[model samples]
Target: MRVTTFAAFRHRNYRLFFVGQLISMMGTWMQQTAIGWLIYQLTGSKLLLGTVQAIGGLPTFFLSTVGGAVADRFPKRAVLVLTQSVMMLAAFALGVLVSTGQIRVWQVAALTAMRGAVMAFDMPVRQAFVVDMVGRDDLMDAVGLNSSLVSGARIVGPAVAGLVMGRFGTAPCFYANAASFLAVIGGLVAMRLTPSPRMVSPESVLRHAVGGFVEVRRNPRVLGLMAILLTVGIFGWSYSVLLPVFARDVLGIAEQRYGLLLAANGVGALLGSLVIASLGDYPHWERLVTGGVFLFGVCLVLFSWTTRFHLALLFLALAGLGMISFHSTANTVIQTSVPDAVRGRVMGVWAMVFVGTHPLGSLLAGILAEHFGASLTVSMSASICVLVAVGVSLARKKGNGALRPNVTGSAGTAGQES
Candidate 1:
């Protein structure tokens, strides 16, 4: 069972948190799909859609470190509760405005910024808490499982989101997202991890936050890892953002078919996650990140060129595999390398790069698509990814390339502890 990753379920806190988060993630994906459609409908400009998404994503890069500091120094449960509440309120407001026919492009941008601010705080704390629930030994399994759920929700949620948006309206999508936050809050309250001594009396917030940055820079391995992961974020993982374009332009599909396009990628990601979880340990970090990310870039480029929808779908799955491989491995490395004191802050930076940097790719792709074409823009993005991967790979050194997998029994340890 321990080898199976079901071992993490023996812990009461993780069990509840995982189940609740699974529901909330599904709703969040549903809302995300709806937002893109709603914004596209209202503005009728690809640039504006790009702008709206850029607004939502930009704040995470700025505020995540502060959020991480709070996570490391305070009770993660309290931090999560506060952030989730803020998110719920923002969702409710969006629903109300859209429902009343008063919503504008600016309003969507503003509200999305609000939610993004909340998420900046939420991501690090949530990631940091994984160790608390399962310990370092199980971190890989937990991370894999966590990643799996996100992919699972992506697979199922979009299909449901498209249907709801098509049948009902966008308001319900917003409301559902707001309601999902409660599930996360409930799980946080049920957790049972003890805070460290350093975590208490956290007065020097600035100093503590800076510490994480200093530490990451000081560690050659981690700095290299960040560089590798940055490529993955900026290029490899833009599939979800590009999905709407693929559905409308390349495949010439409607709502359900659009949903299936995402479904194929999600299914692939889910399978990737399950593979990582069953590995029972982290693989060679450098090789996995670089190779996986390289494959993603290659697949995206290949998929962009294909006219056949079925063939594109196959390539998308390959892209998903590479994307998840990059994600799962990078996560394992970062969590393992950092000390507990600054773990949250380090993971915050990870979230910033892995997710926050995506807006740049999205915005660039949108602009290029508007000027040239969607296919060319996607191809350009893939080209950049290839360059990044090759450049980073050549510069990378050994030992830092593929550290041994650490699978100690304790969940409290970082994956690097092996």
Candidate 2:
């Protein structure tokens, strides 16, 4: 519940990057909200909405590994700059199209696909670059604190987008998002993070990409973590994409109210992330992730059954708390578990699962909502998530001591007795 995790800010580069990232995140959220609202208005089809989300994830699913390769081969700073520029352009393009009345469902989906492709490279580089600013020792604190700012954006972006889109339509929101990129770009340009050498090397790019997969394949704990995250991403995270429908159709809420509802989730998420930031390293973080995932599913099931808006909001707060706690912990574990050299690729692989599957979930949920109902989609996804959590627990029990993983080549591998 602490507002700022300033202890991690002792590192000069981290402090600088944090401020810029905070600003950039707000714009990212703004664009996302505006895009969703626009898509809903234009197509009025939940299936298209789902397809837009699915298209955006295309790059993450396909290019993320190569994006990691790109992060590995090039200077992360340069890569970030390029990706951020691409994002800015894409946002601007969407805004122009909407403003000019040239936008259509296919256009939105195509643009979203372009942005997702850009994100495939952008996310892994950014996630990997955090360690460069803060180092591994304080990496968990840095990651936790970073989530606070992102959730903060979740707090502000939607509300702002809702108002802006209401007053000026979605175009201004898109323009604002495009313009927000300059903040991160400026922050990255100003940073003097020293370039570090690669931990693992191969003669060719394909070989290097394959090498990262091989290294990860050797580690069962990382696999376990990835599996858990995959479950959370596919199920626990689909609610947001479905929210517009809930706001418009189910909840009988207005445009700005959608933003307020999201802000409520952000409030819970921010609180949870700050709590993690305030903590020391959690040895039991694995169980925390698992428990959060399970709690998220439980909350979602109940939330789906609700007809009262205020009651649904209360359940959403609980779901948000579980979601952020799970995400912050999973990110910390992955960053800490992987070695530095292949960390970006490993993180990219993680993003591939965490972000890549979101579209599929959203698409299915939207289709279900269109045909069946939101409640059923929410309930079904949550039920599947519970099953996924159980499977994850069983996998962990089987792997413990039998096949531990240690990327650090240090003592006390995961699943081993200390």
Candidate 3:
């Protein structure tokens, strides 16, 4: 059977969720671009930029485990509603502060931290909820499409934010982001989902959290994937913290051109996501995951050294493509390998390593950039990622089978209703 990229769209709930998320995420990207630009404008300090990002991510690092447990114990949709509502309020508050010209660096940090805390609960639950919407059969397609949605927004949001900020300022971006939440909330309200059985453990939330860690430890495949994700998350993804620096200092570009650079990256990511979606039931996930990481690392290293605007954009686009390819495949592999009962908890652990470590990466990048300059710091970080990818590939060659896909055995049951 031919695999269609839109296979997941057959499910109504998934369609609603997808449409809502695409719209909302565009606003999210806008806000994210604005925040980074605003901070860079306000402080002009690389260290402060990284510091603020670190503060924002710290809450997810600490609390995502408990958030995962909450997801397993409650209805995922309801949890998302609450979390989304809080996030909307926080965005609006930031917009108000910015519009009134009373926005300080501390205020930005505080609001960012608030949103991060909400996302600790939001992200894992939202990830696990994909199965609830479309079940397991089209999970990979759904995952790929969802990634494309994010990347698609990434493409448009930064470009539009640049125009908006250049004309009206950053406040409008925040306000726009706050308003975007309504689409998602409405979609959640409109969905008619059959609630799956909850894994309501009699144990404490801490115990449930511990069980998640135990699950990762017991599954060597998951453990290996998590290790790679951690390495990439820390060194590879954190390079984004330096983009504003690269744009202003190295590329000598204004906001409009900077936005184009971001959009270039997004376009690459979107193409990568489409490739994944079109693969249907292809089984060579290990190849995609490892190759994608290697490509991303190489492109990032090249991008870090390039001062020419066009060359930098080309490298960043390739890096973005590699990034989403690895991310989407890894997520599919992990989700399929785990049981539904513990999916949320496992994803929570995933969030802890993947999202949580971002703060450390950002902070480290900032400190390094402040002393060594952004170009050298980014190159050094990307080089680490390259080394790690090569190591993983060599290890896989040794027939350890840790990174290989095992989708047909017990794992195949992951998509079935609980």
Candidate 4:
């Protein structure tokens, strides 16, 4: 039977989740664009830009494992509702502060940290919840579609935010984001889901969290993927922290045009996600993962060197494409390979390496940008990413059999548990 690119949409629960999340994520990207612009406008400091982004990642770096443990012990939907509500409140608070002209850097940093703490829980549960919604047969398609949803938001959110910010100021962007949460919260409440079996254990939460690490250690392919994510997370992903600097200083663009630059990246990412969704059943996962990363790194390098606005946008779009391609494939592979019992915990580790490492990368990027300038800093980081991708590809060719999908861990029965 031929699988459709939109197979996941056939499931009612996933459809609701997708539509709701699409709305919420657009709000999220709007807030993100506003925050970055706000910080840059206030401080005019590249290091602070990186520092603020790093502040947000610190909580996720430290607490995502514990959050994963919570996911295993409780219902994911309830947890999501709670996290979404908290995030809504945070956005509301930010909106109030900005609207009142009382917003300060410290306040923004604190709220960013708050949201990050909530994400530490939300991300792992949400990722593991995909299989619960669509079952194993459509897991890969679901993952790809989710990526497309996020990328789609990235496309619309920033463009809309730019127009709003240009006309009304950043406060409205925050308010709009605050209101967007209602769609997702409502969807979560409306879903008809079976109760996820709680992993009752005599172990402490720390021990349960550690179990995820143990599982990754036992699986070589998962371990290798984690390592690759670490490199990409730290060096490759951190490049975004410099986008504001790049836009204003290098590309000589204004606030509105900067949003367009981000939208360009989103367009590429959206296309990439659609490609992945269409090829959900493809066998050669390794090639897609490595090739995507190499393409991203190369485009990022070229992007950093470009002074022309259109040229920079072109490179940014290609980089975005490569990024989503690598991320969506790797995520699907890892989720499908792990046992359902430990999926949340394993995803916690994934969050730790992927999301947690962002701060370190941001700090590094900020420092380098402060000293060497944004263009050179980005070029250097992109070079490291390119080199890492090449190294991983070479190692795989040298008989690293563990990188292939494991038959024993196949999603058939392993994904169906509770």
Candidate 5:
């Protein structure tokens, strides 16, 4: 049997979507990098940074399930277009505020919250939209490529942000992000997506939303995976929220150098995504998830302790590699294992755990950084992730088959991807 990395690209619609994502994600990263730096530079309050970040994510936590329900009920392309348009306007507004010297921390936080709310709906719909584009035969490969696209953007966005912020100002990054959305909108408009099979319920929206929870309850594998994602998303992946602190106070680096640190992480993440793509539907996704989680935690631990800038870069890169591998495998497993009727709902739950947990982690990290210092706060968080991995591994050893997905779904299965 042979496995192909670019299998999903056989579909023209997916190809267009992928290209659009490649452009938009870079701009998103640019805005993220600029915003973090701008906040830290203005206030130098770790807790405030965390607070703003948390505020943004709060909507995703509560509304993602509803967003999933909307995806299941409506056309994903339309949902995506609406969400993306709103996000673009938000980004442009932020840029205007910053450029006019009218931007306040409260304003930034408010806009961030608005963006997060839009993402709450957009993420699940976009995630479900992938299946509509390529079906199940190439899901894993497409997922890998998608991860690669994100990391590839990470590599470019931060670099550009650093340069632009260092020379002109943070406003430019925001403006660039706003303009980038046009590309995504164009791609979406150009797509000729076949209508996906819809899940209909003659019940209240609340009842329909609750059904997503019930689906996860019935699947032990998905339950365990979501638990893992929550742990990692909060304690593990939130290390990024602290990177600005790490670069400024700890490593004593300039904004450009800080961007380099981010780019280095992207370099490793890109490699990780490519490696997953090359694996070509490997069977033991559990091992990949566990190993990646453990490695990510360990790398963060090392990164926090390391005083040298170069060494810290290496650790961050390794952390990125581990993070992407863990997430991509987990995403593919969830998408392929669940029934088509509930795929959007489950993905919404997945997005909730994956992204919604970040606010709590950011808040915790910010508070800890203020009291204990950024280095120690990050170190403690990483340690918690390591413990979570160990606990889950031990629990699974005792006869729970939750580590592996069953791969029985209406659209297709993970096993079929191979």
Candidate 6:
């Protein structure tokens, strides 16, 4: 797109942060690709694959709100640095266990859950930290570019991990992921930014955290978006856990080809993110988010019915486009609309809605896949997403209204503090 499409890169701190995050996210995706294959390869159980994913989501469900409160109470940079370091250690541990031939299904599950716990804290802080770096004006661009970076990583990580795991095995993927954290650590260290002014509350921690809940409840737009997000997270995202099954059992593709399937999805997501970036702080974010959800459901349904590998890849790519469009828009809208006072805690609830429900979906998907077959399970999930989108549309017609009319104009130039 235009150079203006990447205006967020004009800010030095955001540029540095973006580069570091890109590297780290690539590693994270590689680890995810390898882990899914490893779990399935070891257990040969679709249920267990879903179970591992469920385990990963469980901590986020339980602790993400508290994690958001922690983000508000503490320095986000310090929190992120600490969390990133712990995640690095966890990755190394997984590598060691896998490389030693000592890795078991249970160990993988436990480690996945542990990383999820760290992410419960890390996701909100990291997301909230974006505004601190770019401020309000470039917030939309920053969000879009960040998502593009993630989608870019998704492309590189899975394709490379597929080859890497196929050749050197899964351990190297974990080790590589562990080493990649250094980039993020370095970025955080190098950045120069003043601390953000918190809407510091006089209330107790519990009361302060609870106040975030109240803030969201008072905003109909945020409340409705959160409801839609929860539904999407629960039904729309669990296709990830089923990919290995889809590749092996449904499409009859080899393990090496699995990465290609995942990469195809990434390519679509990258395209969608770039389009969002090009839009550059557009006012009609609700349209983008809702439309994306509708397209995602349609693509997923198409993907479910496809037995041909090439066709499946095309459908998966379309689904990825829709998925990222919905997600990035929702993220930018909430971040820009909320007051900085409770941003962290509010984002914590956002994290809970966006990710917390995945555990439930993963568990349900697993059970459904075991009995109903992968194609039908995925098709059913896709149907739910379509229904959710339609439901949202109807609800909006009944006067739920747009997200924060005040946020409708161009972003203010004042950069948010650290």
Candidate 1 lDDT by residue in tens digits, 1-418: 2455656776777887888889888888888888887887786676677777878888987888887887877777777789888988998999999899999999999999888888888999989988888777677788888989898988888778877877888888899989988898887777665555545645687667777788789866677778766766666555556667777767777666666666677788888888877776434456667777788888888888787888887888777877887788778777877776778989888878777887786676667667876677777777777787777677665334533344442346321111
TM-score to native of every candidate shown: 0.91, 0.91, 0.96, 0.97, 0.96, 0.95
Q: Measured by C-alpha RMSD in angstroms, how accurate is candidate 1? A: 3.3
Kindly report which residue pairs in candidate 1 clash with one another. 134-411, 135-411, 135-412, 136-411, 136-412, 136-413, 137-410, 336-416
Error of 4 at 364 (Å): 0.8
Candidate 6 vs. true structure, TM-score = 0.95
What are the candidates' C-alpha RMSDs? 3.3, 4.8, 1.9, 1.8, 2.7, 2.3
lDDT values, one for every candidate:
0.76, 0.77, 0.88, 0.88, 0.86, 0.85
- Candidate 4 has its poorest 10 consecutive residues by lDDT at 409-418
Give the alpha carbon lDDT tens digit for every residue of 1-418 in model 6: 1226788888887888899999999999999999999999999998998999999889998788888888778877888899999999999999999999999988998988999999989998888888777767677788889989999999999999999988999999999999999999999888876655555667776677776688789877778789889889889887888999998898998757899999999999999999998886465667777789999999999999899999998998999999999988888878766787677888989988889899999998999999998889989898899988887777666764585323444443333444
lDDT measured at residue 322 in model 6 versus the true structure, 0 to 100: 93
Clash-forming residue pairs, model 5: none
- Selected candidate, larger TM-score, 1 vs 3: 3
Which of candidates 5 and 6 reaches a greater lDDT? 5
Q: Write the per-residue lDDT of candidate 5 for residues 1-418, one digit (tens) a residue.
A: 3458789898888898999999999999999999999889889999998989999999999999989888788877888899999999999999999999999999999999999999999998888888778777777788899999999999999998998898999999999999999999999899865554555679776668777889988987888889889888788856789899998888898889888889889988999999998887576777788888888899999999887999998998998999898999899888877888788888889889999989999999899998999889889899888888777777766864556644445663221110
lDDT sort, best first: 4, 3, 5, 6, 2, 1
Q: For each predicted model, how many residue pairs clash, with residues at least 3 apart or on different chains?
A: 8, 0, 1, 0, 0, 3
Off by over 4 Å in 1: 1-4, 193-203, 391-418
Q: 136-188, model 3: which lDDT tens digit per residue?
A: 77788899999999999999999998889888999999999999999999998
Clash count in backbone of candidate 3: 1
State candidate 1's TM-score. 0.91
Candidate 3 Cα errors over 4 Å, as ranges? 1-4, 409-418
Put down candidate 2 lDDT per residue, 35-101, tens digits, no spaces: 7778888877887777788888877788787777766677778888899999899899988998999
